[model samples]
Target: MTNDENQELKRDKEILSHIQHRYDEEERRFQSVDTKISSMIGVLAVIFTIQASLFINILSNSKPDICLIVLFIFSLALYLISIYYFIKSHYFKKFSATPKPSFLMEEGAKKESEHTIVKDMIALYSDCINDNEKLIENKTNIAKKGFSFLIYGGCLSFIFLLCFLLELFV
Candidate 1:
């Protein structure tokens, strides 16, 4: 092989290495975001379970009204914050887009296997990004629903408190 040919081969190797590095980086980012979202879900589930317990306790007590009202307000705040984190995490997952490789192989092209691998890597990255985008969109909708529920619950709790206060004082 000529010097020029050797230089081209080295350059191609470097390019391939760079692409692989980028792919690895993107995969790590994707996993990190997935982990965060999973953690958030677990936390929200725990919060919900605790709130349910609080509600049950308040209902079973003799002087339940005030306690229920206070607990509901606190739960509403927590729900709101959880929803915010949910949305933020969804956005992070959505916006972490990675560039796709664009090395096409023609007839009689050298390094066909390497080129094909790069193309496959690009396709994999594209698919992952698409899936993440869909997941984030769904999560965003769910978060909105959760926010609405929190608002309604808070209002109802406040109204209950008002009634209880009226009955007690007036």
Candidate 2:
């Protein structure tokens, strides 16, 4: 009912809104990362299916020469692409999104000095949050790149296998 009480309530509401926004942003980033990873896994699964079918077809057709060569090339390409993706995912997840140390220290003297220190601490925390956002963006970019290449590589291998099968049977 009081004016001061209303002002305090308004400030608290604003702070709560800001915190919710940050949490929502973080959750969205995490979901984006998860989606990218799931897509990459799907791509890999398709590649493996193709490879398996190629192997079975090659063995069943009894034409080892041509089928073997095609399979070898396709497998080699997939292997190389997998290695690249592995390295990229490894590095991105390992180095990115590392939280930095807070700037608040325990050595401030006097009330005014403590106030300034608290302000600095808040600024540092904000900077860290910004840094985390940038890191998430970087991770998303890396995942997107990896997923794109994975899809391309998987499709290429699948097509290659299909062509080989067609050539063998027809």
Candidate 3:
């Protein structure tokens, strides 16, 4: 190969390396989102447990206050919405992966020019990166909504606890 061809080949290799690195980074990012979602679900489970106990306490009272009952209902609704969103965010999403070694070998054998092979691989990686970006953004938005609802539900539950305490002590 001529010097110019050698330089071109080197440049293509570098570009391919960069794009592959980006694809790997995106995969890690996707996994990070999944981890966050799992943590949120765990927290939700704990909160749900606490809320269930409080609800039972309210019901067991001889004279349950209508106002408290209404607050509990609203709070319960918010918690349900939050859990729904969380589950949606945690739903399985198929992500594009890099080509397997066998596929790479096949492509290498079929392509006459290494440059063309590199270019094709780069294109594949780019497409996978784009697809993963969209999915990650969607999951993040849904998780944010779930977190907001969780906060709202938690605040209401706290208020209910305060009222119950006041009623009991005074």
Candidate 4:
């Protein structure tokens, strides 16, 4: 092959390589997000354990205040909402690319050239990016919801604990 033709092929290959690299990066990002969400779920479980223990301890008290009981119920509801969101956050689907369909082949079949390969690669990379974009948005939205719930739960629990402590000390 002529030097010019070889150079052209190399450049096309470089473009495809860059796209593949981006595709891989997006995949890694999705995995990282999934791992972080899983960790958050674990933390929420621990919070639930503490909440349960607190409820039992409070109930065992001989003179239980009705207001404190109401606070406990409110906090319990918040915890339930938080756990639901955390579980939902982990449920977003991961993007998995399938092999290029044979139907995508051009109607007029010709010898496979470097240009054709590069074109196909670019198309596949475009599809990959599109899929990843949706996945990222979905995961992010669900994560936000989960975090909001968690924060609300924490705030309610803190208020309850502060009031309960005041009751004991004063």
Candidate 2 C-alpha lDDT tens digits along 1-170: 57976676566556545654674577577666766666665656665676667666666667556645665566646645664664465356432221233222232333444334444444544565576677677766766566566566666666656776676688
TM-scores, all candidates, are: 0.47, 0.58, 0.89, 0.83
Highest lDDT, which number? 3
Q: What is the clash tally of candidate 3?
A: 0
Q: Give all candidates' CA lDDT scores.
A: 0.59, 0.58, 0.85, 0.78
Best by TM-score: 3
Q: How many backbone clashes does candidate 4 have?
A: 0
Task: Flag clash pairs in model 4.
Answer: none
- By TM-score, how accurate is candidate 1? 0.47
Off by over 4 Å in 4: 1-8, 98-111
**Model 1 segments beyond 4 Å from truth?**
59-170
Per-residue lDDT of model 1, residues 54-155, tens digit only: 656655664556555665666566565665666565555344444423333331355555444555555655665566556656665665565565566556
> What is candidate 3's local distance difference test score?
0.85
What residue pairs clash in candidate 3, if any at all? none
lDDT of 1 at 68: 53
Rank by TM-score, descending? 3, 4, 2, 1
